[model samples]
Target: MRETSATRRGVLAAAGGALLAGCSGLDEFGESSDEEIRSSRLPDLTDDGESQPVVVETMPIEIERTVLAERVQRTTDLLATLPMSFGADDVPNGYVRKQLIEAAEDASEYIQDARTAQSRLTAMRSLQRARSEARFAAAGWGFVEDGTTETARQSEHEAVIEDANALRSDHAYLGEDPVEAVLFHAEVEQHLAFVAENRYPSGSVNTDELLTVAEWGEHTEYARARVDDGRYLYDRFRESLPADAGSIEETLTTAGESLVDELQRRRSDLPAEPTEGDHELVWRLRYRVRDAAESSARYAGDEPGAASTVLRGAEGLADFLAYERIRDRIDDGEQFGVEEAADVHDARDQAVESVRTALDESPRAGLARPVLADAAQQIVAADEELARLRGTVRPARLDDPIRRYVTATARARSVPAACQEVLDTLTQ
Candidate 1:
């Protein structure tokens, strides 16, 4: 993972050049007016001649392969400029340099694999992941370099502010009380303070701990990714959404109240103290659910999908809690019993059935296609992991068995939330 001297020089040279090239403008994000939003096409979640509106996944554009190849080549060219090896002393930030090399190497591997990827979506995911990682590493190197002065750093921060503002504005244009967009909007403001004032926000990222420009660049990309994710989710649910403000607000209010009630029931079911392992894990999960409930209470009445988002989060917490609960019960060196194996198999079967049923019934049943598609994808992953479980796990290794079992169960448990979210979304 360590960079060679020549590699370090090449990476720094490329990144420095990028710094000089300056930040791109916000025009790429595109602007949407209220009129445009009202007339937007409903997402194509069904097919011609289809009796049922199945879980239609977002399809790649026809030119995706060509575009992806070009992107991969660009990423490859950027990393190819780096030399093969370097000493720690060659760079001021050895930790960051090592990370840069690792990221570059990973990007290279992804680029290679992407060339022959069977699935377009798979290839796109890998390429985007690689690009983001490279950008993060490049930013790290650019900010830590001695030549990047305070003026340069401040300029980069300003660009990030513009990026955040543009993303927020686009989210606002959705105008259905996009919960994640609002939350991310608030988050960017907090991060802005962190970068500009050296104050830490409640979020995971601490801007003060890292070089200001590096943190700003990293967070800007992070926010961009989050905003993109939210857009995709909303698009999935927006196909059948009512156009009037009163209907949207009423649905949100009812869903929010229901979500809060559900959260309360789940909270009440949990033991006051951990009956098995460390209390901190349980407490953390509890707090997360509590936080989601609080957020649901605050925005559910106004935000279009806030209740559903909170409910989904609460379900995820439950899944994690399930994993931790089982993990603590498992003893090191103990053979994973037939009973546990049966449980895992049962969970897998039920999850698969749930996803299948959702997909099959969605057209006639009015289930949300986005949630069903998401659940189907998760189940596919869980099935893949479960398939490899038998010969791979060792009786003496707790970590392996724990991982295999918990991963399947957690993923399986998460599938049901899609139905709940759909129900909440449709509530009047």
Candidate 2:
């Protein structure tokens, strides 16, 4: 798990990224222009004969932010899986978790396939540099090396998917809890699509701006590819999860839906217009920055892996439940009797504490805040609800507490209603 800015966690996810456009030979987004700048007061160059071609570039900044989000999402997906993998069997849980993590690492190798606009531009610049006599000139080492590397690395993707998937399916009955990898997969895909759509313009945008967007595009493309490969592993892991292990699947499903909704809101919440460009040269920059910020909707969860953290935390609680269930099975006659009500309360309290710890640790692992927030909120709510349910079970015989168990389940057995509430405000 990656460390997060806990200091900033209190802040509602930032309203959005900063967007500005200008031409100081740099776009308001802080990207360099594509035009080979020349100092001149040429009458034809300006409406007032006072301005030069100040092409604005924005793709660089956008790409930088987008890539960061993706990297964070990728890491969090794995870290958040821990608590969920727990069940009666710690060894299998650890084994499966390791497999998932390893699979993610394998996916990462190809995530480089997608480059941001900047990387593409860098490639172009390197080519130019190689041809130039400038002391800074040096050809990007790749061209052919990159292709070979891709070829060598590419085959691993499909193989990883196959292996991971098989493992998950094979282990499905282990009584291990789930981490809900599908939601993670879906969100990463959404981010990939978002990044792809923001492809920076080449001829119309600044050189640096073009490079930035291209770099981001490449990166997302890589992520998309890796994720696509990861599907096999993640899916298998989910499938292999013990059917009776825990209720993490349900909890993660709910959290994922909420996070996805928020993602959608952010996607739609893009500024009605790209930042206003001061000049035609900077228009592309404005577009790229908006696109970058928009794409961020995928990776920048108010929480890491946004909804994933909640599921991960719930997995921990669910695993504990599974452990209790196993103990119950072994006890034979040691049922949920009123005499053991105190013990049940203790178990419930333990579950709550475990969940809280999971929430705190989840964010530390880089799960997004919004996701963690939703999860935390849900867990807290669920725990409270369970307590209320336990009260109902009081005086009742152990055999009769089933109804209480069903009723005391989290109010949000599905996606959180607040998910929609939050999404209604977030956007492109």
Q: What is the C-alpha RMSD of each candidate to the true structure, in Å?
A: 16.7, 27.2
Q: Tell me the spans in candidate 1 whose CA falls farther than 4 Å from its real position.
A: 1-97, 110-128, 136-146, 172-250, 269-336, 339-421
Question: After TM-score superposition, what is the CA distance of residue 273 in candidate 1 from its true location, in Å?
Answer: 4.8
lDDT of 1 at 335: 32
Q: Which candidate is the best by lDDT?
A: 1
On TM-score, the candidate that comes out on top is 1
lDDT scores of the candidates, listed in order: 0.40, 0.31
> Model 2: per-residue lDDT, tens digit, 164-186?
34433432212232222323333
- TM-score for each predicted model, relative to the true structure: 0.48, 0.23
Question: Which pairs of residues collide in candidate 1?
Answer: 3-85, 3-86, 4-85, 4-86, 5-85, 5-86, 7-83, 53-363
User: Which ten residues in a row are the worst by lDDT in model 2?
Assistant: 132-141
- In model 1, which range of ten residues has the least summed lDDT? 13-22
- Residue 154, candidate 2: alpha-carbon lDDT: 33
Residue 160 displacement (Å), model 2: 7.4
